[model samples]
Target: MLYITGTPIGNLDDMSYRAVSTLAAVDEILCEDTRTTRKLTNHFEITTPLRSYHDFNKETATEEIIEELKAGKSFALVTDAGMPVISDPGFELVSRLQDESLDYTVIPAASAFTMALVASGIPSYEFTYFGFLPKSNQKRQEKLTEILHHRKTAVIYESPHRMKQLLKDLVKFDPKRLVSISREITKKFEQHERKTANELLHMMDKEIPLKGEFVVIIEGYEEETVNFTGTAKDHVSELVNEGMRPKDAIKLVSELRGMKKQHVYDEFHK
Candidate 1:
């Protein structure tokens, strides 16, 4: 059995008693960084042995861990912060464990994304977690476009250095769009700011300092009803005239009217 543990994101007090005990009791503690995990173990006096299990060595480490589990060894998997396997290593291990009929369970705790969502004041009925955007400009822009069109709230993880660029891109895509930025979660200087992309961009350095990891919550796109009293081709044509690509327009029309994409494509191009 493997214990998928959740560690404190910032505050050490957030570490649960169960997590500490499990870490101490486990045959081995698998962590992304032994040094980082050592601090936590030292704090709680958890003397269980620590092993390196991160992205670089996950493929090889996973198989070895599987064999140990088969031999009746129980391990606890943790990351530098937050829950293991969430935008972190351990996913492959968990998936492999499932495949091999090995047992595992999660020890829930604080999550920056969910905390940011509730604090954002945006409608949380439905939302999407887009962990981190691509580092490049073109790919990031394409992803930003997709997020801009998403009808539900979107959550994103970003670094301090790229915070400005993210806000800039958001302003370019939709200046008036509501966005919430949360940083230093569970720490002394934790801050949550809610404003439009343009407003936030203007106040970047002055008010919102670039520091700590950031969780960006963007308000969902509210699509307007398209009342086109015309043929399917005409509907597609009108969208195309408004600068939407023909292929994209066809897809939008199909989605709005609940028709198949190929059916709409045939009508529009016939």
Candidate 2:
């Protein structure tokens, strides 16, 4: 039985008893970094042997792990932090395991995504979890564009260095979009801010330490009100004039204005 164990994003006390037991009991533990896993193993006093399994050697690792699984070995998979197979190397192994009909379940623990969600105070009843934006500028722009059309709240992970650049691009595209920046979750300096991308940039200048890992929660693209401040509103009004009802026009206008439907309708017609 393979176990996908979630480790603390921070704060060792966040580790669950089940996670410790799973780490202790597994025949072999796979990790992205042996040194980091050693810290966790040492902390928990888990004696399971460790094997390195990172993205570069994922394919080779999967082959070895599969061989072990086939031989009736029970192993635990963990990453440096958070859950494995989630924006991490354990995905290939999990896919291979599924293909080979290997039995596995999660020993879930703390995740930065959920920590950010809770800190942001956003509704999680309906949300889209986007692990990370593309690293390339073009692909990242494409992803942001796709997300701009999404209506549900989105949870996204990002590196500290690129986060500032990401906010810049986000503001360039749409400055009014609500975004939440969470950093150093579950740690002494843990902080979360609910603001627009532009606001986040300014906030970072004033408040954010900008030194830790980050998870960015973006409010999904909602149609704006007619009170919008830019050319985007003109595009929506143009759509309304093209045989579209005021209601539909308001919907389009709201896509950029972040205003009420009636206000958009009134402004569209007025």
Output the number of the TM-score-best candidate.
Answer: 1
lDDT of 2 by residue, 1-270 (tens): 999999998899999999999899889898899999999899878888998888889877789889989999999999999878778887778889899998999999877888788888666778999888877665676566556556788988888788788888778667887889898888998888998788888877569877888898887665561234455446555544343444555675565556776766665556
C-alpha displacement of 24 in model 1, angstroms?
Answer: 0.7
Candidate 1 per-residue lDDT over residues 1-270, each given as its tens digit: 899999999999999999988998999999999999999999999999999999899999999999999999999999999888878998889889989999999998888899989999988999999999988766676577667667789999999999998898788667889999999999999999999999999988789889999999999876552247788899888766544567877887787678999999999989
**What residue pairs clash in candidate 1, if any at all?**
none
* Runs of candidate 2 exceeding 4 Å displacement: 225-270
Q: Could you give the C-alpha RMSD of every candidate to the true structure, in order shown? A: 3.4, 7.1
Query: What's the CA error at residue 197 for candidate 2, in Å?
Result: 2.5
Each model's C-alpha lDDT? Answer: 0.88, 0.80
